[model samples]
Target: MPELRITTLIDAPLRTVAAALLDARLLARAVRGLGVRISGGPVLFAGATLDGSVGPVDGTLFVTRADTTGVSAELVGGPLPRFTLVTDLLHTGGGTMVVDSVEWSSPGGPFGRLADVLVGRGLALKVLEARAAAVSARSVELLSARVVVGAAIIRDGLLLAQQRSYPPEAAGKWELPGGRVEPGETDHAAVIRECSEELGVTVEPDDQIGPDIPLRADLVLRVFAAHLTEGEPEAVEHRAVRWLTAADLDTVDWLPADRVLLPALHPLLT
Candidate 1:
């Protein structure tokens, strides 16, 4: 089977750009009017589903793997059998570079090549563009939230922490200030609101920490930098609040889900 490749440059930060591509909900939203349905697992690399029409032809594509590095999808049990498409994402300076390749082996030799030339390239490119647009819009949406935001409040090279409110499930473990997403609210807004309601202090959502990192179970956390704007840090919803430098991060008890954000947050703070 021969491979066909296509590459394009996207004008956005790598991590931010990558988050957009990894989100299945964002993909579905971006391809809304295109007669397509897209869905995916919680984590980026888990898997995804794509179903819809390309021009007059209908097909379904299954993403076997997707992450910050790349996305791989196969056209299984579709109009075109044994066709596979893979998209790789790379960080380039302040933007993201996307490369997509398609490969297939059909019994109808020469005729297959001709079909690929006539239809495959165009269809593949359209899907890539749709994916990119979805990611871009989602990034902007996360950046525009006013309340309930993901936060990593660092002081003197250490991140701040709060003990979980709920017991057994998330009890006793320390975590970044944030909470469940509310209806009609952006992830960033949800984080900000969680901080305010839990800490009894106003926090300003500042910079983004990293890509939308997914937990082992099902939570997708969009981390951001937040600054304390009002009130002393008080234990309202949580058991306690403390500041931990990079060196102290390992010492404090952390929630299992929030562990994913540490890798990305550590380097920035320390």
Candidate 2:
């Protein structure tokens, strides 16, 4: 068996780096010679599989583990069998540190071992390097882009939604309580501040709900799961406020961006 490891430092937050690494499309682009397709859950989630082929050689990369810290996967039917890959992301002083490790066994006996040393190592190294570069570029893009935060405050199996009252075209549409992330403010802090200003309440933000959605060329929308900590909510800046059950999601005319998140929001209500 032979093992190879590569480490890279990305000038981006850990969250941004993790998001890029977990992206199926980005991973597919990183792979060479193979046309990969996602079959089951997300690429990073356990039990997910990436089915593809390298020329005539069929390959299936199975995700074995995934978490905030790292991910582990194995390729069983490719040109390299019993090929294992593990990636770890750590928060460093300057940015995020990504460590990738790969292990594989040669197929034949002496001849196979010789080929692996001469050719296989180079191929594997190139693949890992390409993947690292892809992640780095994606993370930089996310880091430089502006972000809008939306808070999904759920209580008693009901989600809070607000109606807009300004900007004629969007006046009657519904949306979550949130706004732009101010300079030097974290997403969680922005969520707390926005909810307080618009809804007149204090909220504790939790994990993100869904993917980061593009709002404009320079802005992206991210929704977070939240809970009330103090004060009852009132529509201070909007036309109205309502607590809705999962089944009631489609009843309102949500703003396009918020509407895109309905499927991910439903699970929080239950």
Candidate 3:
């Protein structure tokens, strides 16, 4: 069997780098020079069948794995069952290191490597190098993606809003009560968690209430209609909490992102 190993260091966190590599849309954009494109499921587990030109050859790239730490794939349904590729992401003091290994068998004894070099030059080696560089360059752009959750609780025909206590930029602005979604938490789960921490109450999200408002270049805010399930709503993390009727909505100065929802949130309130 003939084999090839290549490694590169990327200046991004492991999760961020892994996300860029596993993302089908990003890969499609990055792998252009290799002529590889995701042809099947960017599935639940991020599985995909890839096909494209590898020099003069065309065939399917079979993925054996696509997980958090690493991924593996093999080129098949072609002349030589040309290659099997393994990739890993390791965390280190500096940043993430991407290690890629590929294996292939040759017909000739000692000449197999020479044969691979001569015959499979384009797609097997050159394209792979270009693909790796592409992935590295793409890392910075995706590092900023963030998701935020907010709760809009209504009770007795009034909508609950809270005054920000800290974070100078938002110190006095009124806004929906919620916070960042932690890893492995669903939106509703985040809503419930945020309510507990900020309001000292439990809330059940009934439905999503407004558009996904962009909080900044990379942060998004999603508001959910919730009902308090337990404990009294208190300003545990804020300056104050107020419930306002629909007609009084415009009276308070709201955080820009939360204020955008008022029109959509109007009909939902009593």
Candidate 4:
């Protein structure tokens, strides 16, 4: 069997580069303009699959093993007769470098051998390039943007809180009554809409608390202080809802990001 190898260096920290390589969605985005299709397993490990097509030919590749030291993959099915493709990822002092190699034996006889000589190197390089692009795109996406909104409904000296009951992302955690902002709506409008939908209470547009606070990942979070006008807040989207005093903020498990708002909220509400 003959082998084809290709290597490239990426200018990012090892951990950052590793994470992008491990994420399937990030990998897909990096190779966006390419006509190739790609998919992978839940985690970077043996038995995980990466299936895709280049031009007219389709193929499925599998990760045989991966660890802190390195990672490897094998090509299962493709236009070629028989082949195993392996990729190794390593951390260098300056950045991470990825090297991909392919080993294969001819299917029939001299004709297969000649075809391997013509196509193997080209195929291996195409796969390596696609993988590299995917990793880079994922890194950029994760670092790009994030946005969150929190609601503070204060009556007397108490703040309103809700316990979410949905997916792990939203369930079992106590948070202020707001969500992501939608397109074409003002922050104030989004807050009012969220309060009405989540708590079943109508808030005047003027009741918004203050300007949005910027967070990591280009995220902007807006916290609003509004009054409950018509009815008591019910748990429509959450498992529970309660009015809490400034002292009660410490008792519940608030989201880590929202916890940053507590100290400032304490003095203003109390």
Candidate 5:
């Protein structure tokens, strides 16, 4: 087996590169011509197995390990010998360094070895570079430039907290069920939109609580005090919803930003 290593520089933030790499579907789209598909029937957790084809070569792309910062995959079977690809992302002074390494057997036996001696390494690496670069350099402007909102609904001396269902980092953590504030939309409007979209209810905002909290460089978190206008709160996008008294506040695993408002929330619950 022969291995080829290539490192490409990208002028984007590390977070942006990391976010792009973690999205398997986006990767499939970015390198669609390479015939890589995440449609591996069913995937387990943490990573995906991609089915792909290049030239006379076809194989299942196995994800051995994957995370925000790095990922490793192996291309196996088909007309080609088995090989693995390892990719890493790191922050550099200018921007980010994406290191891509591919190690694989070419064509197979005698005839295959002959082919490799001719142009196999070049051909194989050409395809690998195309695929890897697709993942390394897609624009991440949209991912970083986003803002979000949260709602704190207090009723009957209890505060409502919903468990997040996605973004494994915040999964199962208690938070207010609100989403991104739309363009030209007020925080109150966003609270209503999110409550209706996420919790299946209508709410009227009473006042703003705490202060604007930064979720990221470009994302902001805002909390609002509101009362249900109609319909009881239903867990739409959340894993579960619970109303807890002041005594239960300290015990609940509130999401980090939401936890900061616990003191302010205690007064409203009373």
Candidate 6:
């Protein structure tokens, strides 16, 4: 087995870089080779598969892991016998340092080993450099994006949900109670404040749940697990509030952003 590593610095927080790295389209473009246009993939979540081909050399990029820390993708059914790509992100001085590492094995024994030493290694380096460049450019655009924090307040196996009353399009659509993170406000503090203002209840926020959902190029939505600590909840800002069991999650029309979190939300209840 042979390994190649490349490093770069992106002027963005680890979260921002992590978000950018999850973009399947970005990964496709970054890994494109020799006029190849890679396509066909899901949202790049962990365990997702991206199928691509370069002149009949087919490969499936399987995402083994993805998180705030980094991503690991294994390439199977390609020119190489084994290929695993891992990206490690570390917080540095006001930015993040990214390291892209690829471990691979060439097929066909001696001749193949010689070919890899001569050509494959260079091609792999090019791919790694391209991926780093793409991520860096995308992360810069996300540096100032605002985050909207949603609280999934659960009690006795039921999740709290609220219906929108304003904005003609979203009226009656259900979503978690939340709003944008104020400038200089931490995500946890924003979660506490939004629940208090929208549900009229005090909440103790726990860890975040689900992948960060992008609402727009400049906005992202994050969900947090929380519980009531003081005051009963009242629908102070929405049309209605309901407690739903995991089985009842799909019964209501959820806002598009919140709907994407259903998979992650189910585990908290069950």
lDDT of each: 0.64, 0.76, 0.70, 0.63, 0.68, 0.80
Task: Look at candidate 2 and tell me the lDDT of residue 127.
Answer: 68
- For residue 57, give model 5's deviation from the true position in Å: 2.7
Instruction: Sum up the clashes in candidate 2.
Output: 0
Question: In model 5, which regions exceed 4 Å deviation?
Answer: 29-45, 77-81, 106-108, 111-120, 140-178, 181-270
Give residue 6's error in model 5 in angstroms: 1.4
Candidate 3, 1-270: lDDT as tens digits: 666667889988775566556544444555564545545433212234676444444567776666556667777876555667677889999998998766776555656665587545655565557657776876666566677889889898889999998899789999999989888888899999999999999988977664454444355567889998899999998999998999878778877556656666778776
Give per-model TM-scores: 0.49, 0.58, 0.51, 0.44, 0.51, 0.68
> What's the ranking of the predictions by lDDT, best on top?
6, 2, 3, 5, 1, 4
Strongest candidate by lDDT: 6
The residue-by-residue lDDT of candidate 4 on 1-270, one tens digit each, is 777787767676554454455444444555455555667543443445788654344688676644333456555687656567565667788667867666766667776766575556465566567776665555455443354557788888898899989787758888788877787777677877898899898765344343233343345456777776777788888899988887788777876445535655777666
Tell me the lDDT of model 3 at 6. 78
lDDT of 6 by residue, 66-171 (tens): 7667889887877767778899999999689999988877678875666476535476688788899999997887776789999999999999999999899899
Candidate 3 TM-score versus the reference: 0.51
Error of 6 at 243 (Å): 8.4
Candidate 3 regions exceeding 4 Å error are 34-47, 107-115, 118-123, 148-270
RMSD of each: 8.7, 7.7, 14.6, 13.4, 11.1, 5.4
Query: lDDT (0-100) at residue 269 of candidate 5?
Result: 73
Question: Candidate 1, which segments miss by more than 4 Å at Cα?
Answer: 2-4, 29-45, 48-60, 109-118, 145-210, 213-220, 223-270
Worst-scoring 10-residue span by lDDT in model 5: 38-47
Best by TM-score: 6
Q: Write the per-residue lDDT of candidate 1 for residues 1-270, one digit (tens) a residue.
A: 656676767776665556555655665666565545545444343334566444343566677755557667776665555677676888887578877676765547775666576445565556656766665666555443333246787666767798876877778889888776877887667766787787787777777765565342234566788877787777888888888877776666676435545556768675
